[model samples]
Target: MPYQWPTLTNWLEQIAQPFYQQGYVILEQAIPADLCWALYQDVQHQQLTAAGVGRQGQHQLNQQVRRDHTAWLNQNNPVQQQYLQQMAQLQQDMNRRCFLGLIDFEAHYARYQQGDFYQKHLDAFVGRSNRVLSTVCYLNTLEQGGELLIYNEQDQLISRVQPNAGTLVIFESCRFPHEVLPATTTRYSIAGWFRQNSSIQGRIDPPQ
Candidate 1:
């Protein structure tokens, strides 16, 4: 049977506590193993495009700064749709507890080849970007490196998250400056963001 989500039973309370206190939460193996494996299979077969930075019109691919291939999750994929549905539930629960006003979500599969690393950067810029929360779910395990290093306001390192398969990491988009350390092996994961509804003049905040 396909495992249904929101199965943490007390997920709302569990996710809310840490998020409210620290503006972040990590849920381990939150999605079923079968789903994770299925998504991994899709990534193995899909043709990922060069990952870029910035918005739609201003996007750029700077290999010196970051090197990763990405493939956007498509709803036509049953596994992806299942994951999205669970995330939708999580969005609702988060809004209820944190009053985040999250309108929707967007995610993509990211593959970081060996030696590929992302320089320190913030996912959101408070009044500038609409992305409120950032999420990364590891799709494969690594023996060494490819760890996520999160920094604080004083430029001090706070946490080092290992890229363990089935591990889920969530954090505030604007508060943390994070980077991916070069790995000895390829790293696979799903990167996503929860956004608030901030539209004006008929243009969406992110515009896709």
Candidate 2:
């Protein structure tokens, strides 16, 4: 069965609690399980290598794609397009509520299988305004491991997000540092950044 989105206002209220208290929130069963699998299949078909060293000191394989209003609308698949639209709305709503101006979404795929995990690190680049929110939609759940570990400023474990397909987890882009535990099974997710300004896409600014 497809997961129905809560009333926009209701979801907003519910999400805000976690956002402020824990620095992250997870919407369980946010997406349809079947659709999640289909999307994962599509990503596998697209199959890009997990190149590049992440600041977290771990390797990651991702496919980053840029899409705006019109371009995303032209996509052929209804389900896929709906997903994108919802994501767009999510970004817009968050921006407005946070008193941040218009922002862009940088879409991408993140896959971690057995032996693959990302080290703990913040999402925002040093000087870039491109990452304001860290949003991840899980495509498939793992039977074991692959939980997202979030730590406090003192480097103490604060909270852990277990791998659950169809779940959407949101958090501040740079505030919380997190990492993925080694996956016992394959974990698929659509991970992306929501920025405050669309003018400059990626890349954070350097420290002064």
Best by lDDT: 1
lDDT tens digits, residue span 48-164, model 2: 554354434343434231110111122466656667777777767666665655356666677776767776778775454357778878877677888888877788987788888
Model 1 lDDT per residue over 116-194, tens place: 8998999988778888899998888788889999898788998899887777888999899999999779899999999
Worst 10 residues of 2 by lDDT: 65-74
On a 0 to 100 scale, what is the lDDT of residue 175 in model 2? 76
Per-prediction TM-score to the true structure, in the order listed: 0.91, 0.74
Question: Cα RMSD to native, each candidate?
Answer: 2.9, 6.8
Which residue runs of candidate 1 sit more than 4 Å off their true CA positions?
A: 1-9, 201-203
In candidate 2, position 45 carries an lDDT of 61
Error of 2 at 16 (Å): 3.2
Instruction: Give model 1 RMSD, 1 decimal.
Output: 2.9
Report the Cα lDDT for residue 113, model 1. Answer: 91
